[model samples]
Target chain A: MFQNDAFRALDRQESLRLLAKVPVGRVVYTRQALPAVLPINFSLDTDASVLLRTSPDSDLVRAIDGVVVAFEADEFDAATRSGWSVVVTGRATVVTDPDEHERLSQADPTSWMPLRDPVFVRIESEMVTGRGLRGTRGTQ
Target chain B: MFQNDAFRALDRQESLRLLAKVPVGRVVYTRQALPAVLPINFSLDTDASVLLRTSPDSDLVRAIDGVVVAFEADEFDAATRSGWSVVVTGRATVVTDPDEHERLSQADPTSWMPLRDPVFVRIESEMVTGRGLRGTRGTQ
Candidate 1:
């Protein structure tokens, strides 16, 4: 596969577009001075911010609030050895404004684990970058 | 799906088993003081160390060498909202020993990007943890 395909850097716009298409992604944050990643369901808002829903008292909510975090999503094919990945780095803020929270709540980010009293958090993207292998097709 | 199934933490042995099953996983490391995540092809050795092949000059090779890095892999089903994820945190070192390098090279970690001179790196596992949502099966 390396003989036939080449990796290309995706522009910022293209990266964000790909990010918006995926409902599941991994959020990387510092935990005990070590980087930790967790998969979460998310939605991309109109302004390009990444929104996620979790339990009010979950570790993700506590560890990520008001801290810089990285969000990543990708699609790859093992058979063809081709895929694309997008990464976003920014500060994650728990949604607190009543009106804005209500609006985002309507987006309904689904959680695989039972989320009683779901709390919404938004990561305002400060930098976005992505890379893709050309001439490949796969669900990301 | 969360309503029906509960998340269970997997033991270290089980986590390593899952990691070995997947051919591709994401490596997370600090780049310029910011956390960055990249998807790469990998193979797990008998000692539970993660091995990857990349260009000697690749940013991943440079940024991760001698650094504490996090490797993550998962399988999730969107419809059933079930999957498992394993994370290994360890220090990455470029394999320089000829004998060990030759043996690892035989493992055949395929790269999607053209690698004229592939460099092998090993992540010596310092910590391993995993979690799973019960009652689903998929390769991720």
Candidate 2:
């Protein structure tokens, strides 16, 4: 299982497909000229864009408007020490259009915090890449 | 349960304790003037530095040597919609000292891929912060 060729690079389409399945991921953005990462629950739209539901007062909403950010998600089995990780890099835009906002709000991306002026943000995928382990052998 | 003050800030020591329990996290670093995040298996040393195991030729090894980076991890429960996330911003240094290298290598951080020319990197925790939801009511 720990073969020399066990590591595999996932293509763009495959990576996006995986992203659509995972419900939680981390969004990495620049804060005060330094990198910061926050775990978020996200959904994938039909056009492969990532959607996040945040609070209006959230720092992510304030800092990430019209900014490029890296969003990443993965599924790893600690017992097998095998998993896949997908990363999407894109510009985040807050959804203000009433119709789109309503539709996304109805789609109901999970938010742990209480709903008080929920903000919807969309990240259009500019680049997608992933890596996976081919086999499982070692216990994590 | 869904109160306005549900979010609570975690102090540096509390954040480090949570990080020590998690086996995997994403490391955010600057690459070509853009933020890049990658999943890595890590362990916390006595001094609160983040330690990672990777191949010598991996990009993380090449790019993050003596570079400032952010490492983040979280544990969220989908049913209760409660979780805490911790982020550590620090400088990553490749461990080349013979004694320290051997000691870390023996510690055995989980790696899914085959171990060949394994490289150990350390990120000394310069700043650590975390946030957690105090009560669980929403479903995420």
Candidate 3:
């Protein structure tokens, strides 16, 4: 086999589910010649897409057109000794349709990030992956 | 002030320091209508700058041309009951000069990620921010 199980991963729905439960995640993309990572609040849509807002003349907008990118959302509670992370890899496109635009416009950013720009972009999942770790307390 | 103190918080150096420790982080930039996030493996330069590798044709190279962006890295240890996060916001430009490029080219990505590409981008922190949380051991 030409694949190592370490690199081989999961599908969209499973990754999306893990994403939905978490309130935060980092959006990864390339900036300049190096990889850039930024923290953001995101939402999981019915179509298995992740939505977030940005500015019109922003660098993020400049680099991310017609590209297969990765998106992730996750959460952890150290007290309970449990946590889960979900990553979504897909093609990101800036949505233009009005009804779709209105839907994002009407959504809340406070649930995600305090500072949200005027424009919104949605990433439709081509593939999604996730992993979870849970600890159980038991009597020895 | 009208702000959620919990979300609007950081320590400055922590974001930069955390980036050095955690190889994986999210990159945020604009992609048309929405803010995009992708996962990346990065290292912190001795001066506290963040660095990563990429291809010349990569989306990052195109988007981060002297633009303001954020490079964030973080970590959470449930077993240790502690966590911290770091972020850098600044302009990203390509390493057009040769000498600077060679220094970054030698960074070890194996412990980080399998990054292929010669181009390097530095998200110099115009403003560095950070935050941390630690769980307490109590009667559970």
- Model 3: lDDT equals 0.60
Q: Fill in the DockQ of model 3.
A: 0.09
Query: Which lDDT tens digits does candidate 1 get at residues B4-79?
Result: 2477889999999888888789999888888889888788887888888887878888899998889999988787
- For candidate 1, the TM-score of chain A alone versus the native chain A is 0.88
Candidate 2 per-residue lDDT over residues B1-140, each given as its tens digit: 23347679999989988888877888999888777998877889878889888777777788899888999998887766777999999899999999999888777666665666777899989999899866555543
Which tens-of-lDDT digit does each residue in A1-140 have in candidate 3?
Answer: 11111133445566666677655566677767544565555777778788766555557667776666677666544344345566677777787788888887776344322333445667777666665544322111
The better candidate by lDDT, 2 or 3, is: 2
Worst 10 residues of 2 chain A by lDDT: A131-140
Q: Which residue pairs collide in model 1, if any? A: none
Alpha-carbon runs more than 4 Å astray in model 3: A1-11, A17-71, A74-140, B1-10, B77-82, B107-117, B134-140
Chain A alone, TM-score for each of the models? 0.88, 0.88, 0.76
Put the candidates in DockQ order, highest first. 2, 1, 3
- In Å, residue A96's CA in model 2 sits off its true spot by 2.2
lDDT of 2 by residue, A27-136 (tens): 99998887899888789987888998887777788889999898999988777777899988999999999999888878876566666677789988999989886655
TM-score of each: 0.90, 0.90, 0.54
Which pairs clash inside model 2? none
